[model samples]
Target chain A: MQLDSILFYLFAVQILFSALMTITRRNVVYSAVWLISTLVGVAGIYLLQGAEFLAGVQIILYIGGITVLFLFVIMLVPVSEESKQRRFSSQLWIVLIVAVLLTGELGYFLWQGADSFQMGEPTPPAEIGTVTTNSEQIGQVLFSEYLLPFELASILLLVAMIGAVVMAKARPGAE
Target chain B: MEEILDNPYLQPIIATLLIVAVFPLVAGYMVLAERKVLADLQVRLGPMRVGPYGFLQPLADAFKLMLKEDIIPAASDKWIFWGAPVLSTFTALTAFAVIPFSDKFYVADVNIGILFILAMSSLGILGLILGGWSSNSKYSLLGALRSAAQMVSYEVPLGFTTVTALMVAETLSMQGIVQSQLDKGVWIAFSNYGLMLVPAVVFIIAAVAETNRAPFDLPEAESEIVAGFHTEYSGFRWALFFLAEYASIFVICGIAVTVFFGGWLRPFANVGFLETPLNVAFPILLFVVIGAGCALGAVRVTLAYEKAIMGVLALAMFLVAGLFAIPMINELIIGFFWFLFKVLIFIYVFIWVRGTFPRFRYDQLMQVGWKYLIPISMGGLIVNGIVLLFTS
Candidate 1:
């Protein structure tokens, strides 16, 4: 087997396994750690697809930043040693029904496309996975073509920041 | 087999293996160097009982750490605690893959090299926090909390400085940054006619805090916390944390030099008058000075063993000097020499500041990072962007 396929299967299994463990763990700390494992496994999948910059960002921002923050919040919350004894979540039946319907819909699409699956590979865009580097291409497009949207996103973030400070600010009458 | 031996794809693996082998030795000496430098700064003798003015202290320290009993507290969560040091060491070592020591050297040159390091650093903090939380102790938890806050907050300025730097360089690969510096004939810190000085200051301070070094070392504030996150850790596990700390310092210093000081490039690299003398004489002078210091120590020491040890030290330094004197070897090693020379200066400054400065009050640290460094770094970034826009 080619190294690419081998790596893909390995990371694929790892992500699936870790994602399962993340939801199943009784201990919140263990759950947080398993979540990190799942995040890292996804990063490996990105790397396999040659999206190295995305892989790094996934590791940095997701596994590194968000997951660590999760752990921090988990630690701060005063919970007992073990979770409460209720085994299944209250919404399990509804969730299961929705999940089964989603799977049936996906299966219907795959069955419809089965004959076309063996067709020759679709060509990817030249700007991606080609002579042009994906990171540079992403940067050029984001700054030049999608520049307005990007700037608007930053504006949204700035507004959120100012609002947070305003809400947290000390009021003279409250004291 | 021959083809496998020469495979271009095998290069990074080989380089990584070499680094994994040599880095412990390098980190070991960094500890020794820190001790000796800190000792000198305080007007006291450092480790003298080890081999030859503590030259072999790193070896002795390693042996001792290995032999010492590994202790896990009863209250501690065993698995996460055990895995923490391993995670820390792993991330710290992985970051080395992107550090450009010379033009021809480095394990990997990914397009997102700096981001790769930032990712590693952020991930590396998990090890500390996990270690602390798993230890199930008050001091450890508090230490972990402080580290989480300090590192996360300081990461903002670090990100800004790095973005500003790569903006000026117009590339993300570490070597490309150096190449851009060579082409532009100016370091990023001195770019835009000194407008970059603010971000440079921001980077150094943020880097220091990020490493949990002195003045910003709230995580392991010895007097207050009694070894902080690793309070309950002992023996080899503690050694792993120690190794990770030194490795982190080395990597951070490497990034600083690469981004700001011009990695592997000598002073006045473009100057027509000084290339030969600067390249040839600099390394020779550096090694000879070290060799002469050992020789002097050898003469001064009264004890026979101490004298003999100093003599060996002098011989080793002189041998290295002699190797660099060779024309073929000189050309090959000059770039590595200049790179390490600059890195050593950085390491010295780290120790110097540790000796000089008091640990910051937690409130003071937050105030500096949020209130001062962030706004200044933002201004630096804006100016850098404007200059690039106009000049390009």
Candidate 2:
């Protein structure tokens, strides 16, 4: 129980730090790294929930694939310190005011809901094995119970892929 | 608390750490082996000066690497630059956690071991990207971008190949797959789907490209990219990159073993043997033999006598071969040997390809990945799915 608490706090601290860094970093590359840290923290949360496969996919797809692509594009753009320094003054103030109010509201709600949201007992090890059952179960569920959603997701990905290819194709006059 | 401390999960975690700690040392020696094999292939002496027949070359290299100055670029982002190699190396090391060295020799027997490995292995690109961007160099950045594109393009096919393997085995657990193969004498490679072989072959090729190994190594095309993402990195940091590369190699081979070859199961499993009471003892006995060999090699190194090292190395080889006497452990030890042998072959092929083929032009490289490998692997996957559906 103590170990679980320690792990929870550790992940929480990592999430908080990375979240702060993601918004606060001046360098775009550093911000991307922070975002990765945040993603990994979330993956850790997934692992704690015994969703090992989901956690792995989350790390692979989100952090490994998407974020790296984000960094790749950012690097290719040639943004330097001078260009990055330009900041909107009034717009920044407006953004800051909105952020503070949203944070305050979320904090207040969380504080109010704390008593109502008591921690549940940990799942027994025997129950956890069901989650670890081979891919057959996953396939069975996906093909039967979740068939529509699975097909829908595949279609969504297919559309996204086509869109990406169309966007990435070189234009006639462009180098 | 005592019961929790003795939990099975702790065993995997401890085994994982143990494997990670020793992997680099093994990888170092693997480099030496490659050199020796290449030298033999080319009719030349590889590294006879360092120790007798250059046997101590890895150790010498380690010392040199450790003593070298760690250089950080003046304009580089210090933290991310430093963090990149560590993250890369750590991810590569962790990928082996779920890899079954033998039937009972695995650290984590997670149901989704394959996915876990694939996911962890993908993180290597993060290190490359971070290393490149943080270096604030154009060459590194370009190299990073190329690697990112290559990894992203290849990952889809790799996942598809895994799905094909999963479909056949009807299990995602590495052990389960191995067990399934054991029930049939033939490897998954030789099973019903002939087209499945195409994806396995394509997957290996893509894996080579994804790892930035030779011919496909345009990202670090020495003559072109000027050493790529780690161009500006030096000393221990550079070593970390090397560690990550070799670790990734081991992982790819481990995946190959799990997916295509029977992971820890003996090639020819007899039903009578499996049904016998002795079956349970077989895997453990096999582990002990292999473990003892490794321990002996380690002990010989500690003694630091040339004769002892040679004697122990020879003994290790003999013990490894003699493992065949025990049918079950034979498979596990042989699987380990087979996995290493295959990986070494790939590594040599990587080097040989480097020596033989010219680096691809950037556009040509992308074309090979996007145009050739992707379509072929995707087609292979579809064919595999059809075959699996019909056969099963």
Candidate 3:
């Protein structure tokens, strides 16, 4: 239990640090690396939750695929060292202040509602094994209970593919 | 605190750290071995001056890396420049956590070990990308872009081939897959899946391409890209990138072992006098006899028989050593040896290709990945899925 807490805190620290680094780093590339670290921490949290598949997907899709794309685009666009130092707008201060205030209020409410929070009984060890159901169960769920969402996701992917093709194509007579 | 420390779950975490700590040192030596192999292939002695036969080459290289001055390019983003290599190395290390060394050896033994490895392996691309971008150099940027495309493109076939293995094994767990092989008395690679060989072969090629080893090493094509994304890095930081690359090689080989070869399992069936409990004592008793033979210098008198005797003696020592080691440690050693053996074969193939074949053009490389490997893998997966459904 204490180890869990430590891991949680460690992940929280990573999140906060990476977030700060992402915004403040002078290099665009460094900002992306920080973002990768942020994603890794989130993946770690998922692992802690025993969602191994989700954690793996998070790392693969977000860190590997998405971030690599970001890096490729960044590399193709010739941004100078000086330009990378561009600061956030002054209005960001107001946004930060509001965010802090909201967090404080949320924390206060959570504390007040602590006694009312319904803590469930500890799950049995055997239940943990069930959490790692074989891929067959996942396939079944995808084809049945989540069929609609699955089809929607495929359609969404199709639309994105078309959009990408259109964007990559040169405008008529423009090239 | 006591509860957390004493929890059984903590064992995996501790075992993971122990594995991570040792893997890099082993990987460092592997680089030295690669150099030696390359030299031998080219009919030259490689780094013979570092130490006796360059045995201490990795150590010498380590010391040199540590003592060298750290350089952060004036035009580069300092933090990302530093962070990229660390990220690369860390992601590479993390992938090993789930790789089953042998049937009983692994850190976490996660059910989705294959997926975990694939995912973690992909994450290293982020570091390469960031390293390239932060270097503030045109060459680095180009190298990074090429690598990103190469990795993403190759990953498709890699995953598909793995699915094919999963189909044959009827299980995702690495150990379970090995056990399936042991039960059948046939390896998955040699199984009745005829056309499945296409994807398996493609997958092995893809693994090579993904790791950016020679012939496919266009990402760091020294002639063109001037060391690629890591062009600007120096000192220990540079060493980290090398460590990540070699470590990923091991990770890829381990995945191949789990997927195609019987991971951590002996190829032949367990045929011995030790088939029964009473017979199990025979191997140990034989070891005592060999030890006595060696003690009396009888081994020298019978050189041909001594060699055969020594082989058996070595196996006994390994088994005894494995018995004394922790379960995870035992698995790791067995897995490491299995993984190393396979990787050495792959490395030889890598070296052989480097010596024999010409490098692929960037466009050709892209074409092979997208047009050839991808479609084949996708088709293989479909066929494999069908076969699996029928078999199950």
lDDT of each: 0.87, 0.77, 0.76
Candidate 2 residue lDDT tens string, B1-392: 99988676776777777897798899898788778877876899798767545778998999899999989999998998999999999999888877877755777677778888888877888998889888988899878888888788778777877777777787777777887888766678778645668777877777777788877887787897799988999888999999999889878877886788666554445456553333334434654665566556555444456556656665665565455566766544555654555555666766676556767787887788778877887787778788777776
Candidate 1 local lDDT, B324-366, one digit each (tens): 8899998778878888988889889999999999999989999
Better of 1 and 2 by DockQ: 2
How accurate locally is residue A111 in candidate 2, as Cα lDDT from 0 to 100?
Answer: 87
**Clash count in backbone of candidate 3:** 2
lDDT of 3 by residue, B1-392 (tens): 99998776676677787788888789778878788887888899888665445656888888899999999999987877888899889889988877766544467666777888888788888788878878889888878888889998888889888888887887777767777877876667766456567766887899989998877889899999899989999999999999999889888877776677666654553544433322234334544564555444434434555455455555666565434244545434544455555666776676676666678999999999989889988988887678767866
In model 1 chain A, where is the ten-residue run with the lowest total lDDT?
A: A123-132
- Tens-digit lDDT track of model 2 for A12-62: 899999999998877787788899899999888877766666787899889
Q: Candidates ranked by lDDT, best first? A: 1, 2, 3
Clashing pairs in 2: none
Ranking, TM-score, top scorer first:
1, 2, 3
After the best TM-score superposition of candidate 1, give how far the Cα of residue B379 lies from its true spot, in angstroms. 1.0
List pairs with backbone clashes in candidate 1: none
* Ordering by DockQ: 2, 1, 3
Better of 1 and 2 by TM-score: 1
